[model samples]
Target chain A: MPRYKITFAYDGTKFAGFQIQPHQRTIEQTLKTVVNRMAKDPDPAIPVIGSGRTDAGVHALNQVAHFDFPFDIPERSMVRALNSQLPLDIVVKKAEIVPKTFHARYNAHKKRYRYRVKQGEFVDPFRRNYTAHYKYPVDIAKMQQAAQDLVGTHDFTSFVASGSQAKSNVRTIYEAKVYHDEALDEIVFEFVGNGFLYNQVRIMVALLLEIGNGQRPLNDVKRVIAAKDRQQARMTAPASGLYLVDVSYDE
Target chain B: MPRYKITFAYDGTKFAGFQIQPHQRTIEQTLKTVVNRMAKDPDPAIPVIGSGRTDAGVHALNQVAHFDFPFDIPERSMVRALNSQLPLDIVVKKAEIVPKTFHARYNAHKKRYRYRVKQGEFVDPFRRNYTAHYKYPVDIAKMQQAAQDLVGTHDFTSFVASGSQAKSNVRTIYEAKVYHDEALDEIVFEFVGNGFLYNQVRIMVALLLEIGNGQRPLNDVKRVIAAKDRQQARMTAPASGLYLVDVSYDE
Candidate 1:
């Protein structure tokens, strides 16, 4: 068997998520179906593991995954064939043969995610499906201060959603930053972390948004993390604005 | 009656075009519907004239139009309210009261358009609906050279599609440039013209693509234009990648 790592991108607007669930349309299932058909394997049973699970309506700009095949297929040909069969909203960008030990999920070294919010009276119609529309005013400087408070190792129990079943909530966030793009009328929140609790990014964004909107003080984010209770965090922002931008792995 | 000039954006995927037909969904019809309802007149006859007609499946980033209303409505407020009632894909970005002499179609000084093509094995799933996928290798320098040859005044009969009803084929093209973005794996074809004949831009793109693909020489574009026959052009590029980027007017 040969293992190949594939890099892809998706809109995630109409997809349930990256993982395939029974009877639901997902990016994983769509990719697997096309790959199976192309390989002409009756029992495709190809197991594809993504770098991380993205929630419904979340996008990915450079998502990496790996799968094994029974026979050899040209990487470039596989990319073209898969794209021909997949829906317009999903694309397989690059494929390369990797060592047998390569695992997209477990071997990942770091992950970067981006959340985009439009701050204006008018939303861009072309980008409305991809960016969250925050019509209310926000203080960019205050939000940047709040974002700084989230960069460090912490037990993110407060940031995790209530339904998350992870055994431990400890994760190391290397960096968290917020900036404004005046030309595009957008606010961008970027996070690079070793790992994240479920809904951690969204929760952090909600807290920063509260601070930006004057509902909470800039130091409230630190207080919430120290509290270690889910109730202490602000609401989770919508998933539409979130994007799993990149995943890195050691060679 | 008060005349207003409105700047708008639309997805154009679901619209037949900019003009209203007997039984087709159009940008004009959608805007007229909203205006008629807001007027509260049983037979409100609000007519909207767009700066230019864009084909179905083409998009617009900054489209201008004009309409007349009998009653006074705050320009900004009307834009917000109209956007609230309109579909998510169409947005009124700005609205302002203009002099009665202002005409969206007739007063326009120039227009700019962009055609996007993805020239890689893997197409971004999110942008598939908005970009044309070209898997073959493209010579960007050759494409740029060919595009440069298309600038300035020319009788573009060779670039017009067959069955076009335009009375004149002479049009002034101010600029045509093609460039590739390596990070995005995309090529953007931008054009600025005083006016375009029917299917002129699409035909130009098709010819440039041939040049890029090595099917034709760079100077072949000049010969094609001199031929002044619709059949001299290569092929009509798909409409998905075409966008009406901007329409300018003199103050």
Candidate 2:
């Protein structure tokens, strides 16, 4: 058997989630179904493992995944075969043969995520599914200043939602930045970290927005992180505006 | 009865078209449903007349429509009421009280349309519904040069599709331009005209693309228009990439 690594993107508006459920459509299950059909062997189906699970309505720009095929095929042919069978909402950008020891999830060193917030009172129908709408006025300068406290290693227990099953609550954040996209009238938040707890990114975005709205003090992010309690950060932004931007592995 | 003029936008991916149909979901029917539901009137339901009909999968950024209401309501309140009940894919951007004599369709003096073509070999899942994919190489300069021939008043019998109901094919084009969007990797074609026959903009776009691909001579547009034959223009671009950008009226 040969192991393959694939970089793919999907519009998650129509999917249940990344993990498989009995009667629901999911990213992992869809990929496995396509791969098994191509292999023509179902006794022990090929498994599709993603770097992480994304909630429903969360999109992906570059998601990494791995699967082991029963036989060797040219990477180009494999990509073409998978894409041809896959639905229009999903696309495989690149495929390559990798060492058998490589793991899609465990070998990943860094991940980047983006959260988009539309700054306006009215929701644009064209962007309703792609951005979270905020009606209040936001202070961009204050949001940028507060995002600085999110850098460096810290115990992010306050940001993790209740359903996260991670064993450790501590994570290192290499970068955290918030900026405005003038052309799109959107506020984009970017984060690069070792990993993120479930709902961590969305929760952080909610807290940042509150701070920018002047409802919370400018230094509230520091207090919230120090508290290490989920109750301290109350709101979680909508999942539709989140994107799993990129995942990196130590090659 | 007071007439209300409204400007709105819709994501047409889920719509059958802009007209009322017996069983299909349409933009006009959807808008009328919401308006009638708000009006609480049964006999002679409010008629929502749009500036023009948009084909299935064709989007609109600022579509104009008008309807007569038995009772009067503030313009701002009308906008809010319509948007609150309308689905997320459609949004009412503006509303105004107009005279009873004002008509939505016949009173329009100018219209602007845009066609978006993606320059790539692969389909981006995020952009699949918004842009038409062109895999072959294209010459932007040649497309721009050919578009100049379309900027004058002319009989567009060559560009009119078979289903058109217009009495005459003569239409005045105020502007025709082709430009590239570097960030999105799209070649956008814009046309401003007094009026267009059925499938006129799409047919022109297809011919311009063929010219850009070097399949047709540079002077083909002039010859095609002079021939006054539908057979001269063979292609109509996909409706998914076409947009009713704006409609103007001489108030």
Candidate 3:
């Protein structure tokens, strides 16, 4: 058997989510179906392990996954074959042979996420599916200054949604930043961290947006993290604006 | 009755073009349905006259149209009401009361169109609906030079599709230009002209793409226009990448 590491991207607009569900269209199930057909083994379906699961309507630029094949094939050929069979919404960008011990989920050391919010009174018809729309005015400078507090290790219980079953809430954020894209008239929020709690990025975005809109003080992030209460951050940005930009692992 | 001119935009991905059809959903039909409902008249449905009809899968940035209302309403109110009632894919941007003699189709003096082509070996899933995918290598300079020949009055019979009902094939192109958008990795072609016959822009784009790919010489545009035969230029670009950018009228 040969194990392969693959990098892929998906639109996520039409997918239920990245995880498998009964009678639901998901990225994992779609990949499994194609890989199983290629493996020519229905007895034990091929399994694809992703670095992490993205919520519904969340896009990915370079999602990493690992799967084992019953037979060996050229890496380039594998990429072409999978892309040809998969739907247009999903594209396998790269495939490479990897050691059997390598795991997509366990070996991942860092991940980066991006959230895009369009600033305008009316939703742009073309970008409705890709960007979250913000009607109120916002100060990008205030959001940028507030995001610095998200760095370093912190207990993220204040940001995690209630459905999460994680044993611990401590996480290290390597970098967090905010910038305004003038060309598209959009505010972009990026977070790079060792790990993130469920809905952590979205919650932070919501709080930052509030602060930028003057509903909260510029230093609200510090107070919210210290409180460690989910009620401190009530809003979570819409999933349509979120993207799993990249994932990292040691060679 | 108050006649008004409205500027709107739409994501044409799900529309069956700008013209009304018997059973298919179209931009014109959708607008009529909403406006008629607002007008509270079913016996005589309100009519919408667009500047021109766009082919299926073609987008528009500022498509202009005119309609008459049974009663008077403020311009701002009309815009807000139509936007609220129309689907998320269509948005009314501006509305203004115009003279009763104004015609959206005949009042236009100049029109601008844009065609976007993504340059890559593999199709980008995110841009599949918004851009045409071109796999072969292209030279922007060659395309730019070839496009210059199109910036003048000429008989465009070779570029017009077979179904055109225009009395003459003569049209004047005020400007034709091509530029590479590095950030998006797309080659954008723009045309400003007094009028274009059916499928003229698409056909010209196909010929320019061929010239850029080294299949045709830089002077192919001149030769093709001189031929005055439809078979001289056979290829027409896909509609997904075309956009009716703007329409101009004399005050």
Candidate 4:
């Protein structure tokens, strides 16, 4: 048996989520099914783990995952083999043999997310799946101010979706910023954090955009974090705008 | 009645072609259906004409067309109205009223075509619909040389498809070049010509790719053109890689 680490990208518009659910398509289940098909003697219970789960319609630019299969395959050949069998929307960007010690989810140290918003009079249809359409004008300074107020270690209970039940709500956001690309008329919000609760990033993005739109005050982010109530941050941005960009290890 | 000139873009993956055909969906038919529904007194026989027809699966970034409608509508509003009704794959980029004498097909002086090829070990799934995968090493210099040889005024009977019934095959290619975008790992072939015969751009691109692949000699383009035989240039590139980029007028 050998463990293989795979880095991949998926459009995510059509997927249910990254985790397997009954009668639904997911990245984890898809990988297990594919790897089993490639095996000489298929194993239905092969284990495949991802760094974390992404909600439905949330994209992944470079998601990290690992699977253990009972075969000896070269790295380069594995990339070509898996890609040839996978669908067009989900692609394995790279594959390599990793030490057995590496666990995709348990060993992860940090994750980075990118949220994209198109702020223009007309939305390019080509970008509809990848970016959230925010037709209203935005003030970048206000967004940056809200982002600054949210950075640092804090109990992000209000930012998390209501159903999430982690042991602790404390998380450290190493960096957070909003940038506007004039050429594309897009606003990109990137956040690097040790970990995120379910739907935390989208909620934060929605609130920041509201502040930018003058619908909410810039200090609302700080108040929400201190309040520790999910109902305080009501807006949850669409999954289409969020992307899990990278996963990092302590090494 | 008013004549309007419209510039549009389309993904083209689902469209049969730009022209209406029996038992098939097309850009023209889609546009007519949309405009007819928009009209106060619906005219089912509205006239819609494109600058030129694009083959099935061929995309467009700046395709020009004109239509005559029974009602009057402002250009900006028309753009928004048509877009709201049209499918995501087919988008009307701009719309404005034109003189009755302005004909999209007849008044066009030049048309530009762009073909993209992905040459690498693995094709990025994200680019599958937009590019043709060649999966081989290409000689950029060789492709450039062939592009230069194919440029200028010539009897391009060899490049046209066999079923074309044009009176003359002579056309001038104002510019032809092959460029490599290192970041995208793609080769782009751009051709600016007065006009092209049926399937001329695809055929030219096919032969140019063959030359780049070292399967054909640099002088083969000239020999095939002088021979004035479609059989001399057999390969017709797939429609997925082709794009109608621009249309120009003498006015």
Alpha-carbon lDDT, every model:
0.86, 0.92, 0.93, 0.88
Which candidate do you rate higher for TM-score, 1 or 2?
2
lDDT of 2 at B46: 83
Q: Write the per-residue lDDT of candidate 3 for residues B1-251, one digit (tens) a residue.
A: 89999999998999999999999989999999988998996676789999999989999999999999987999999999998889989999999999988999999989999999997657888888888888899899999999999999999999999899999999999999999887677899999999999999999999999999999988999999999999988899999899999999998
For residues A80-186, what per-residue lDDT tens digits would candidate 4 score against the true structure?
89989888788888888999998999999999999999876666665777889888988988898789987899999898887787889999999999998665668
Sort by lDDT, best first: what order? 3, 2, 4, 1
- Runs in model 1 with CA error above 4 Å? A74-77, A96-102, A107-109, A180-185, A249-251, B21-24, B135-145, B179-186
What DockQ does candidate 2 score?
A: 0.69
Interface RMSD of 4: 2.6
TM, every model: 0.89, 0.96, 0.96, 0.91
Off by over 4 Å in 3: none
Candidate 2 scores a chain A TM-score of: 0.98
Error of 1 at A102 (Å): 4.3
| A119 Cα displacement, candidate 1 (Å) | 2.6
Model 3 chain A worst lDDT run, 10 consecutive residues: A37-46
- Residue B172's lDDT in candidate 4: 94
lDDT of 2 by residue, B1-251 (tens): 78999999998999998999999999999999988888896688889999999989999999999998877899999988888899888989999999888899999999999999997657888888888888888898999999999999999999999989999999999999999987677899999999889999999999999999999999899999999999999999988789999999986
- Tell me candidate 4's TM-score on chain B: 0.95
- Scanning candidate 4 chain B in windows of ten residues, the lowest lDDT window is B39-48
